[model samples]
Target: MTQTATRDDDVAAGPRASAERQGDVRLSLQGVDAFYGQIQALRGVSLEVRQGEIVTLLGSNGAGKSTTLKTISGLVRARQGDVCLEGESIARLPAHQIARRGVVHVPEGRRVLRGLTVKENLELGAFTLKDNALRRQRLEEVYALFPILHERRHQDGSLLSGGQQQMLAMGRALMHGPNVMLLDEPSMGLAPKLVTEIMRIIKRLNEAGTTILLVEQNARLALRLAHYAYVIENGEIRMQGDAAAMREDASVVKAYLGLGD
Candidate 1:
């Protein structure tokens, strides 16, 4: 059975109804398989991320969480099945082409341009735009979202703290005005306080109507912020459900999330 698209009305109702609506998926993978040379990284993985929601990919290291994002973004092509964006197939599209269709990926590491000034780094995000006016407008919007970036506009990205770098990474992605933001480990390598701050920024972004697909090691934090989540194991989805329920699952609590039993 195909999954359903989740609407704003469904979320306020409850989790079960939300899951049912999500079962009618928006961005869907139907038996997707991917490989790197002879080693298979993904094995018939199927999942969904509805529009206007934060869906998290939760799992241990090497569980193909990163690979899933790459495949969806067209950085890695699928060997089998299909990847659809709003019911249109993008499996054959290149990474840049997919990104042009409003799928922006922040990647695993905070890959900010180390030597570039914050303003320069953000300018790079508008490289595909032909309209100078539009680029400037978007840049101003990004600065508004992240005032820190504007404060350090002339400072080199390398000089910023880890939290600040993550913000810059996200700010760069926002320059394109994406419909879906694929964030890989946004909380990685930050102090606890900074992590909370970053997650709050993500929440605020979602509240302002940006859809997010977050891949994070901090399960507790991710689940709390996400609408739905998938638990990946050995390159496949082992469990999928509402985020809050997954957070309470005993196995998930003990194994991947490091929560008490």
Candidate 2:
């Protein structure tokens, strides 16, 4: 089912945190309009993320969440408006160019290469990098964050379980040390423990200065992990506010929290 968009559990996102101090704008989506052929998917959508903050987009499936990420990543072109990173326009750049600029996208379904080994898959993420030392540093850092990947570094990524493959996809993205990571459904199809683990890792990434633009189906989890959030419906933003404020909103409970009567 397409999720009902809402926001809840906005207690500073992860455990032991308070209101976050938003910093310099790291990524900006300004008056974006997108389409799939003749069909419009995003209508003047705009949002911003600053350094070291988790900004989430909450919405039902087909509400343009994934499309938004695709636009930022340059997988899909923006027909109108501009996408800027660190104040430079990139709305018309190709996908590889966007990745080179440190806007990494971890798309849904853990799109890892099935035939490639875990290490090989990670190496692909650094295709833009020419420096061998930087690649080695990122590889070691990814291994440090996900020790399971280190243990199975030689195994084909397809051989790993769902949770492990998710880690691999994330690790591969980190090989570029992205400034703004566009994550789509990071917690989908995982057990409760795995979900918690992934969320914790996401929080850690944000803490380490990677600005995040997350699109999630799990509203409560999304709010619990984000500092600010926007709600989208029918390809338009319906609401936006601080995560703490969204948690207690009556509209969120009824639509997304499944408290509808």
Please tell me which predicted candidate would have the highest TM-score against the true structure: 2
Give each model's whole-structure lDDT: 0.82, 0.84
How close to the true structure is residue 202 of candidate 2, measured as C-alpha lDDT?
89
Stretches of candidate 1 exceeding 4 Å from the true structure:
1-17, 22-25, 255-258
- Error at 1, model 1, angstroms: 32
Model 2: per-residue Cα lDDT over 1-261, one tens digit each:
333233233223543224554588899999999999999999999888877788889877788899999999998889998999999999988888889889999999999898999999999999878999999999999999999999999999999988898899999999987988999998788876677778789889888877899987777777778888888878788777787667667687568545443
> Which residue pairs clash within candidate 1?
3-23, 3-24, 3-25, 4-23, 4-24, 4-25, 5-24
lDDT of 2 at 101: 88
**Candidate 2: regions farther than 4 A off:** 1-12, 15-21, 256-261
Clashes of each: 7, 1
How many angstroms is residue 121 displaced in model 1 relative to the true structure, after the best TM-score fit? 0.6
| lDDT tens digits by residue: candidate 1, 170-232 | 999999888889999987888776776777788888878788899987776677778888888
